[model samples]
Target: MNYLARDPYAPKRLIEIGEAARGLGVTARTLRYYQDQGLIRSHRLARNVRGYDLAAIEQLKAIVALRAVGLPVAAIRAILVLRDQPDAQVRALRSALAEALREQQAQIQRLAALAEGMASDDAALPPAIAGLQAPSPESATPSKP
Candidate 1:
């Protein structure tokens, strides 16, 4: 039995717009958006049909992942800009990522503390109150509840 592997030469033929969009799990419109942002470049074929190289598909995947994580397109563009530089862009992206991560961690800690406080309050409440004290029609109902 033979298993098919990716064809090393498959990328030689430029992929048409639809094929390229499908490869990147995005609509052609999204690819057009990327083009507008100068994120990916394509070529025109006969009758001006758009075509992209396999490398461009890979770039689209990166763009999707970074955008999904809330990173601005500008940051992603900066990261991509370093791709052609002599030095690795890891250093530039790393500092920004680290600062953002630190802020996120602090927010998480604050949220966890608030949750713990709420849990403590729940624990301290009397069982009757915790279980919901129904009004005898003599007592007023909780305005919030």
Candidate 2:
């Protein structure tokens, strides 16, 4: 009893905002925001209602994945366009990604250096400051009047 065979005229699945949000593990508000930002598209079902078909769902997934990797919405849009013209765009996108990676690596090195410096400073703290300790719990509490 194959369901598809039984119903030859089954309509394509049109996911509503809530269902799509749940599928993506995002809030409906976030979905709406993405829609507003023009990061993803939705089929208008009515004046205030919207739905997403399979293509739209896949596009939204791509948007989420790109955003997760720190690509800005503008960059994601450009990358999406590159999908249609890969040969023409690959070099540019690769250059941009390489630049971003270099920037991130530099930031990581700066943070590591700062952390190492702080560790050394802690090791060299003045004896008076290093020897200070919190008051014992009993001493911290006031006696009853």
Candidate 3:
């Protein structure tokens, strides 16, 4: 027997678009967008409706995860193109993830600074607005070693 054929994790069945989308917690339109992007493929069954094999569903799961972290479709496509080469795939994904992490970290720092500014400006506000403000996180938390 071929090594790939004996793999336990290989998909055994296919599912329709609705079932696949619900299972993955995404809309059918999202699935179509992925299809349009050539990121995933679907089968046409009965009256031109779409169906997804388990392998496609698995790919959708990964695509959903990547998109959730704000990875661009192009980057995901670049990574997927290297799927057959695990080393290349990992390298591409690592580069994309690192770049994404830097963007998120910068955004987080900016938001934190904005919040800090808002807290500082609280004192200049009218008593009504000022009173509604919670204690700054720094003041609320006990100092750590």
Candidate 4:
């Protein structure tokens, strides 16, 4: 079978909650939690069988990413609420994502600076040991052990 030759434009298959959670890198409990919070929509398949739309999988991915970055459920809900109003919310979501990226960049820069400072001073120490040292120059001063 030439799976690589499969069409990219093919329609997405419906996924059950378990499959959706696995695809989105979350637990089935988390999916149930999102459902409880009305963050996602699902439908009943057959006797106690619940199925989710493929679009919900994408939403779950976004939700997982946002949560991974420390965004609260309420804030995530606000963004999901805007999903229905494409014209307005699309711009808002884009702006929010950009802002998040900028914040993450700033945090990375700060950590890098800290790491560089630690590496420059405290010579003759192992990298792992040096990393625990305070990043500030004051901390590098000799003192009673």
Candidate 5:
């Protein structure tokens, strides 16, 4: 068995941070932040410049999508940690999505409750209060003699 054989599916060329950021529709600072948060890893090709492999870019896409849907950094990290295990990864992703859905549903319920309360309060307002309006400029100004 040739252990050194290159996988055909692997990225043939690495891309710099700027290109990766632009391709991902994110800023270089955001990529750096992801690196800092241990969410994604970048290759240090030289003294300061960083590059990313295709796998890294794919990971960034997943991160961005997860974030767009309101998944927190911690949950994203947890999902990433399960990447190596295909079965576990699916389970983890599903669990995270379920949790996010529950949270969104709860938030919607809370907002609906608040809106209903406000509606009831508006209905209960005294007629004078409900009818009150700010005086228009024309009404405020005295009529010329």
Candidate 6:
């Protein structure tokens, strides 16, 4: 279901590049880069002006979201193409999201271990940092026993 195409409120009015970028909390260059990447198309208002309709704005929103989660431009371009194919889009997105979740879970474990080590100020090197045999130059100052 292409919701952007079906939106009844989609105005004929054009949103210029700067406005769209501001609304999306991205730079104008980023929007232009997406156009260059063929992820989204914008209207050519004049020789120097670029514009986007509401549908394209929605598409840009999706692009921004996908990029936020560490997906590269090539991956985003593929996802945008898949939007035209519902079955494939769902399958691809699910696979990407599942992989992201797995990666995030592993990252959380590593960060939690680091945090635990940092939280214990008095401990003689928590297990996570126990491999080190020498303290840094900054830790040369002896600690109280």
Could you say which candidate leads in TM-score? 3
TM-score per prediction, in order, is 0.56, 0.63, 0.72, 0.56, 0.66, 0.67
In the range 1-145, model 2's lDDT, one tens digit per residue, is: 1111112333356677778889988777777877787777766543445677788889889777766655666776677677778875676567657766787898899888666756864466455556989999877975321
lDDT of 1 by residue, 1-145 (tens): 1222244433445677877778767778877878888888876654566677768767888887776665666777788889977366787677657766786788899888766756864356445447985669877764310
What is the clash tally of candidate 1?
A: 0
Model 2, runs deviating above 4 Å:
1-11, 121-145
Worst 10 residues of 6 by lDDT: 1-10
Compose the digit string of candidate 5's lDDT tens values, residues 23-139. Answer: 988888888888889999876544456778878989999998998887878899988988889899889888999999999999999888666756864356455557989999878
Give, for candidate 1, the lowest lDDT window spanning 10 residues. 1-10
Question: Candidate 2: deviation at residue 55, Å?
Answer: 0.8
lDDT of each: 0.69, 0.68, 0.79, 0.69, 0.78, 0.76
Q: What is the lDDT of residue 34 in candidate 1?
A: 80
Predicted candidate 3 versus true structure: per-residue lDDT over 64-122, tens digit per residue: 99989978889999999998999999999999999999999999998886667668643
lDDT of 4 by residue, 27-76 (tens): 77888888888888666544554567667777888888887875657767
lDDT of 6 by residue, 22-115 (tens): 9999989899888988988866664547778989999899888987886667767776778779999988877777776787899999999877
Per-residue lDDT, model 3, residue 41, is: 83
Evaluate residue 11 in candidate 6 and report its C-alpha lDDT on the 0 to 100 scale. Answer: 44
Clashing pairs in 3: none
Worst 10 residues of 3 by lDDT: 1-10
Candidate 5 has a TM-score of 0.66
List candidate 3 segments past 4 Å from native.
1-12, 121-145
Where in model 1 is the C-alpha error above 4 Å? 1-12, 86-88, 99-145
Give the C-alpha miss distance for residue 13 in model 5, angstroms.
Answer: 2.5
Rank candidates, lDDT, best first.
Answer: 3, 5, 6, 1, 4, 2
